[model samples]
Structures are given as C-alpha cells and as structure tokens.
Target chain A: MAFTLDEAQRIVSIALNHGRDAGWNPLSAVVLDAGGHPIAFARSDGASPGRYAIAEAKAYGAIMLGMGGRAQMARAEAQAYFMGTVNGVFGGKVLPVPGGVLVRDLDGAVIGAVGVTGDSSDNDAEAACAGITAVGYTPEP
Target chain B: MAFTLDEAQRIVSIALNHGRDAGWNPLSAVVLDAGGHPIAFARSDGASPGRYAIAEAKAYGAIMLGMGGRAQMARAEAQAYFMGTVNGVFGGKVLPVPGGVLVRDLDGAVIGAVGVTGDSSDNDAEAACAGITAVGYTPEP
Candidate 1:
C-alpha cells in the first residue's frame, strides 16, 4: 500500500521536531513515495534554502538504490566511478550520505524513504530513523 | 520578513482542504519564499507525478514576473515571444495560468507565492486564494 499524505507529513514533522529537541541545527525533511515522487516536504524556518534540495536528494538516493544511506556511502567508496555515473543519470540528485533512511512495511518491503538534513550526518540519520519508527514502520538504517 | 515554515505548511494544508471540501480532484500545492526557494510542498495521493513540477512552476512564474497567474497569462497571450523566451531561460519552469497567486503582507509587499494543481485552473486559484486569506495575507488574484 502507498504511504498516505498524513503519514508522509508525520515523518517530516517528527524528524524536524527530533532535530530541534536534540539541539541540532534547523532541519529540513522530505518524504518520498514508493515511486520516488515527493509526498511531503518542509524546511525549518531558519534553515538554508539549499537544505530542502539536499534532503530530497538523500531520500531519492536511498529509494533509487534500494539501500540505506550507509550502504550507499560504502558503495560510493568502493565503486566510485559506477556510483558517480549512476548519480549523473539521475542529474546529481543522489547524495550518498547518511540521513537517508528507507521505510519498510510489515513484510519488510521498502515503501518509501525519509530524508533529514541540517545537522551532523549521523544525527540526521538518527532523526530520520526516529520518525520512521514513530510511524510504525521499520527504518532501514 | 521571511515566512516561517509553519505558515508555509498551513497554506499548503488549507489549500488542499479547500480542494477536498469542494470535491475537486486530488491536488498538489507548493509554497515558495520571496527568493523563489521552495519552503513547503505536498501532493495528494492520486495526483500525477508531474503535478508537483507544474504546481511549482506556476508559483515560480508568478514570483519571477512580480504578478499573479492571471496577469502572467494575459502577458503570455499578448507577448507570446517574450514569455516563451523567458520560459526557456528558466529551463521551462514558468506556467502562465490562473492557479498561481501572490501572497502579500500588510504593507502590500509581496512575500511569496502559492501554486495549486489537479483541478481546473480557476478552481485551483480559488483554493489558493482561500488559503492565503485564511493566513491573513492578501492574494493577488
């Protein structure tokens, strides 16, 4: 089943709230549907305008690669040329960095992804995972 | 002053709510800052994947032209060559239609623009104006 708009907005809001509570920098969050189309997005008041694009890229990368951000990072290092070429195919929208977490349903199939930015990459990943779990889905961290 | 993320999200939500209340088709809405940067975006469940780009272009066109969608449309009709050239310069991101409304603050200064899609252009503009008014902002119709 597709993730509803309500679920997508919850993922964005919860991720931003988690970043705030953790005293991280202002954050931006984006939720993409299984088809890699954006369902919801929000940039915190003081976040830079570029944060939204970065956040959206993170989620797009994770969804397109069918792996979590960490795995993508590892692949980027091991197959730099291949990864770079694939990123080029997507018009430089694949950011192989932490903070992109895949959302899975009960059957462990990926349904979508949540991306968070505006903090340390590790912290961003933590917030993304928190949001995914809060929505009763497994976060492929 | 800049629009807070809360206000952007509210505009998106209110516009979608209006569309639903009026039994319009599934809708998509986007809000851009005065600098033409995206602040918030949402697409309803059944909207086509292309809806987001179209909605964003509508708002971007209005913000870039310093006028509402209707004005943009009028100019587009009167100056087809100029409008087409401008669209090419922006990588075809301008949609001269009735669904893009400019948001004005108390001083009659433009703050941002909202774009809505998925229904008829007139209906989309109606919802956009409703959302802007709900937030106590004037909508340049």
Candidate 2:
C-alpha cells in the first residue's frame, strides 16, 4: 500500500469534495509518505500559505504519533513531559491537531497519511477518511 | 547584517561554486534561521529526492547549537544527546550540523543565521561565512 502521487492527488480531491459538500469555502490538504515526509499537497486556490505548513504539520503529527487525535490525547498521560520536549525537537514541523489520518495496507502496515484543514476538526477528519477510503486502504480500527 | 534571503541565496551560490570548482557535482546548499528554521535551499535538480531533508538537517544543526558541527563531532556530549533526543521527540525536525553561521548586525547583535551544505563540512562552513561576511557581518569574534 505504498502511497503515490496519484493516490495523494485523489486524497486531495475527496477532501475538497467533502469540503464543498459541507459548505466549507476552501482548504489546503497534504499527504505524507510512510516516513512522514510530504508526498503531495494542494490548496483550493484561495487558501493561505500558512495553510500549507499547518496541513503538513498535522499530517506529520498523525504519522509520528501513530494514532488519531483521540488516541494521542489518551496517551498524553502515559508519557509525561512529552509535549514540551516534542516541539523543540522537530524544530516546529509537527502540530497537535485532529486533521491527520494513517493509511494502511492490506497487511495492516502503515504506508502513508493524509491531512485536511480549513474546516472544523470533525469535517477535516471526515475529508481525510474519505480520501483514505477512496484509495482502497482501510484506516486503523 | 541580518541574514536576509539574499545572503542565504549567496551562501548557497558560494557553496555551489566551491562544489563545482572542486568537481563535487550535484551538491546541495541551504540556509536556516537562528532557530533552525529554513530560510533558503537549493539542489542540483538531478540530485536525490532526499536532498531536501539533508540540506535541511545541515542548516538545522548550524542554527540550533550556536556553534556549527559541534554536535556531530561530540556525539557523546550531553548537548548532543539533548539535541538528538529533542529531535526524536519532535519527529526528526532538529538537526545539528557544523555549517550554520550566526548572523549579526552592525551593533554586534545576533540577529539570524545562514547554513550551507553540498560539500565537506569545511566547505559548508566556509561558504556560510562568506555569505555572512558579504552582507557586511562577521561570523564570530
């Protein structure tokens, strides 16, 4: 389940479509490689430049933490001092947000991730999920 | 003597010239802020896709520690350990290398920094200093 440019593009499309359907104006979407590197990104024309950074950060956070936002929130109690030390480490490349998704392969291997922004957290997660599903990969149960 | 984009670009150009002059083809150069943030970057087009990450690391290392390459050389130092730990905690964003130069203004105040890569650490540091000096600033006392 290696993520390619085509799949990342499709993810952006689904996210944008979801945005349109939800009456959200526009957004910037980013897809990260399995190593949490950027694979592809696109903005709906009017999105601000900062959106690009935020989208990348959100997607990166999802992959690095290896869990969705709720799970990340749950684990915060286990690793004390994780938050303060983490920000200085990536030098500001990660964000703690509910907009990133892990893309897994048939064998449950994590291959890549998708992040969506410019809307509410729920809507952003929904758009990312749509894209993940569009690629025929299932998210973690 | 702030580390302007122009100075950053010039550092890359200097480092690139040194590489080409010495027959080190397809090198990369990058400049970063005092906080290990990116300012400018360049690659020889046909270089590896990982060039972005590598160049970024060189720049990050230079800016984060206040001294260039100190972390990479003294890997066992507590400072290096802290830097590496911070990077892992932040998801690989902090990089400590020896090619970063602290930028200063006429009043002898540290304002920003510049970093360069694509050649040996010696050349990387040389070019960074060249660029900083070209902007009418000294590298260090």
When candidate 1 is compared with the true two-chain complex, its DockQ is 0.80
Best by DockQ: 1
In model 1, the runs with Cα more than 4 Å from the true position are none
Which 10-residue window in model 2 chain B sums to the lowest lDDT? B38-47
**Per-residue lDDT of candidate 1, residues A1-141 (tens digit):** 778899889888999999999889998999988878888899998898888779888999898889888899899889988888888989888888899888878887779998899998899999999888888888986
If scored against the real structure, what TM-score would every candidate get? 0.95, 0.50
**Could you give me the TM-score of model 2 versus the true structure?**
0.50
Clashing pairs in 2: A89-B86, A90-B90, A90-B93, B61-B95, B61-B96, B61-B97, B68-B98, B69-B97, B69-B98
The local lDDT score (0 to 100) that residue A29 gets in candidate 1 is 90
| Clashing residue pair totals per candidate (backbone < 3 A) | 0, 9
The lDDT leader among the candidates is 1
lDDT for residue A123 in candidate 2, whole number 0-100: 73
